[model samples]
Target chain A: MSSPERSSTPMALIVVAWALVVIPLLYGLVQTIRTASALFTG
Target chain B: MAVPGFLARDRIVAKPGFNRWLIPPAALAVHLCIGQVYATSVYKAALVADFESSLTAIGAIFSIAIVMLGLSAALFGTWVDRNGPRAAMFTSACFWSVGFLVGAAGIATNQLWLLYLGYGVLGGIGLGIGYISPVSTLIKWFPDRPGLATGMAIMGFGGGALIATPLSRQLMSLYDSSYDGTAATTPSGSAVALLFVTFGLVYLVFMMFGAAIVRVPAEGWKPDGFDPSTVKSKALVTTDSVSAANAIKTPQFWLLWIVLFCNVTAGIGILEQASPMVQDFFRDGDASLVTAAAAAGFVGLLSLFNMAGRFVWSSTSDVIGRKGIYMVYLGVGLLLYVALATVGSSAVWLFVLLAALIISFYGGGFATIPAYLRDLFGTYQVGAIHGRLLTAWSAAGVAGPLIVNGVLDTQGTPGELVAGDYRIALFIMVGLLAVGFVANLLVKPVASKWHEPKSQTSPTPERSAAR
Candidate 1:
């Protein structure tokens, strides 16, 4: 698993990692903005 | 290295060229899964009907898990540092998901104690281990910015709840066609069993992503262009090591414990009643200014602040020292509570802004504490210290709710109460924040007598020698 040939992280692993983190944060951000707007307008 | 216990160790170990940024997502995977514990309320009513139990009886499940989380973290934090993140995370995966599996069985068989034992005790041990598994490794890797590293990971715990709550509600609806996504309706017992099993299976894969990728830095590794001396120069920051055992003996430790306790007590006390509090604040005539949906929106807004503050304020502590950051959390927190007591009901915007800011500081307090521990103690047992410090959180979890509810009960029920009803509790929150403020002032650098000798700076597998 720690071979010299496998020096770089796989592309798939990088994509999954970014997706896992970025996706939820974006969703939460979008939802929060919506609620925040309502807080003032209400 | 060939042993079963260390199977994924080599796979996750970072090679020379590996980027440190890759680590946070791995940590996020584990945290997001366990954060589902906060989503339990979505199923509480469902379980109440399924098991024919009172809401208080069901609420005890989450309570036991949180208590166990504190205990297990304090107990097993050192084991995590010694054995490495992979081993600790894998063990966490087994305990956490298995706890859910056992809980599924309990639900199926209608055994309440089994639910308590399964989800409460076993899952809690998993939460504690899972919570701290990445902390030591992340700190060691990013010694340049310990606050940012630990905050990124701890932030996930708060974020996890956000993801789980909606997902669980949707899943419950899917499982029981009759569930209309409301509080009154309970999903089918079989559906709950299925939900438990699904969560267990999903979380295993998610947590393993972290376990499979997490690696400790080699002895004395530092990031490019990072100055080791600069970190040391920051106020009250140190490279001096304190054993987790000795750390507790230090006045700094108790000071931090009280600091964390008060901050948490105030925040959790308010947060536990967020939905109800919003209605209580603005309720006037028969038709209150704040409706249920608006109240829910306010709760959602607070959750966002709660989660984001974990990353934003804690990371800010890297630039502004941990002590300064906590001063803001406590000092400003006291002011906000006062405003909420005196002027909160004057305008909806004022109430919302103050509550959100207070929650952000609360989240910041949690994420910043480990780095705070690192500054006063050192990395050698920072995870363990962080674990022990979490007992403050468990204590606050109980005390916070008690303070809020006791006051609220005497004032009036949730909907009938107005801002006046909350004046007493809000003042108490101010008093609690002042205590934390005083504790922060008392914290100074640890004494030289406690420092680990220079030769033993590198991590050792031996627990007795390591701390």
Candidate 2:
């Protein structure tokens, strides 16, 4: 028997979906580092 | 129901009669390299000295790598299962090698961000993908002894640090002392670059072998001498199978997540400050450099125990039930942390022994859970579920170090200078372990509602058609 379709999002849309997830994660990481540096240096 | 490009169920499950043994060694090779995370401290002093970075700043690099490991693994899990281990393993090796190269570049240029980008993101991705590649395949190949099989593979993951710690230390020393220049203190940049490149190339070759040899067993294939009755006798869950989708919806998945989260967090509290923690407890006004080296050796000793636990304790889970094994891990672990908190370093040997046991259980918990998942859910889509569950690891990677380091940072003085400095952190670990114990207790045999009863009820089409 074949595995059922697990994703309905198109391949292109899936790329966008990943980008959406990854970009926010990177942004938050950058902000954390910046904030940490400021606090420690100050 | 066959999806295009999906391996036939029979093919996916079929036993490759001769090649089964090759998979674990492949897993070990990759694990030995990724295990370098345990030896990160070897570079910490160098990084601080060269870049003028703080302890917390250097720690952030490691934290980023760990957090990314879980995240990338979750992202890559489904792809690994669908595409097979070769693609995933090769990709992991490439990324890991690139990460090392980038890290070397960072050191040469004294650029911190590039090091983070290379080692943290790139190497983390490799870690994530390489870690999961062999897990589901090994479980499927040895369904009767999944705990042992996955443990065999994952034990390598835990042990990787053991091998890496000593090797990295020696390499660093060789690189540092070989310098004949006027600069009396500074390690040669060329030596560091060469070491990184050497490690990267060696790991790439080793990982490629793992990727090449990986093959999924045929569907419904059992080992030639194995009996289902033997497996059932061990008090382990023996389900016909549950799809990954169904498994995720069950409470068992979430409970397992909590158990892992607590176990990892508790262990990391000690692991993050192992060197300092040891020196603080046994302060005798020795030279600072000597004390630091001793502490580093203690860290390496802990790595050995961590590695051993991954194999020995997890293998034990195959005979005892997973829940029963976890009860020991959590219960004993809680007592140990509590003892460490209240005893105030009076019985130093006792402290070391108990801490080692707790750390071993932490590693064991990681090694055993893949097999546990296979037991609760069937091989089908178990990789995906395993991937989703790794988010717990990612969360704990952040939470564990935070609890330990954050407390130490707040305390602001060596434990020797201030009495009971680590008492609060030890108590926190005890509390976390208690939470894990409760979570383990709450894990009931997965409810029948989650099982793929429809698949079970259907006639064995292959058997019937053959007849």
Candidate 3:
């Protein structure tokens, strides 16, 4: 069996990369959810 | 134009031990920005009022943009493949940002043609190139789960409007203090101009980030423990690669085209009329039981379902196989359309549920297609093939609205439509879905004649030299 390749990339880089996209995406989803809630609320 | 050495396909090859997960975020950055194409309605009325033009004239800006998106994708698919993702993405950012800058100028100067030339043409080219840039890279990264990788990126496209709609409102309100973000008020033309500039600069930065981070996989790289033989074992999945040129000549490509056209057409029927359809369905003579606010909420809800379905259903395709998942999208979708036409108006909840489910299938069809192409065509030129297939989307963009609007126009005018007005359109969608279902059934493994020779299947000299 081949040994797993060691990743040189830092974990923080991955987190920062994801955070740049995910934070805005979550904000958008939240905003959409708030607007959509009006359907069931009424 | 010669690609700069730094932006060449050879320069961005991944080294050993690179994490594949980083690619999705890069893909999202571009998609989220281009997906802003859908949120044009936020400032649409302002553009119409400012230009002193009819709604159709202002609406043509969006139509032109969508048409250009389809055209540019088909035209540039192969170029993007040869040049690699970074170059395509950087080029897309330039066109997209400059498009907005020019569009802002047009808006400020009150020149409508400039808006058409800038936002509609230039920004749409950005939309097309940016859309397919990362798809093949993502598929390459996640060979074991092509659908999931693609779903993540395309979901960003759906999510783009969710962000842009609210963001545009806030930005417009900031620029035009006289106009609050409400139906009763429209922002000034100048406000929209500033909003375009802001979107242009912001999207340029975001898309550039994607370009920076995206890297093509090294030759012969695969995820640990992923079995290529298992993938080939599945029905209709090909181990061999087909060039985009030959792919077009095949029956499978055209069948998938028919499949996509039908799916998108049916989905757009509900999406284009989502807000009003809810109110019309529940109308008690003159007064709608559904309020305008609730109807807007229904649109919001459908957008949510649309975004979620892109991720959920495409991911599910990894487990169920692409053909089977599409059967659900088309076969089950036909029954859903029938239920919608017959019983949708009987209850508000039923109407919303049916519409939301149908919208979900529409979105699933979009997100799942790249992976489907990968299955039948292999990754060699799958992105280009995928881009060619998007012509169906452009076609459906016109056909879907035409069928719905044509039928509705015959029955009654806007604001006075009832559920019965939509029966013919819904039935037409049902017929279209039946067509797509049969296309899906006809899909088979690509004939061996279409496959590239063993010599061509390996990484080219330029890519190997990059290493």
The residue-by-residue lDDT of candidate 1 on B387-422, one tens digit each, is: 898999899989999998998899876667887998
DockQ values, each candidate: 0.40, 0.02, 0.55
In order, the first chain's TM-score in every candidate is: 0.69, 0.54, 0.77
The prediction achieving the highest lDDT against the true structure is 3
Point out the higher-scoring one by lDDT: 1 or 2. 1
Write model 2 residue lDDT over B435-456, tens digit each, in one string. Answer: 9999888886677777666555
Candidate 3, position B300, lDDT: 90
Whole-model Cα lDDT of every candidate shown, in order: 0.85, 0.70, 0.92
Better model by DockQ, 1 or 3? Answer: 3
Each model's RMSD to truth, in Å? 2.7, 11.6, 2.5
> Which ranking of candidates, highest lDDT first?
3, 1, 2
Give me the displacement of residue B272 in model 1, in angstroms: 0.9
> What residue runs in model 2 are displaced by over 4 Å at the alpha carbon?
A1-42, B1-16, B174-186, B229-236, B284-290, B410-412, B415-419, B453-467
| Residue range with the least summed lDDT across 10 consecutive positions in model 2 chain B | B458-467
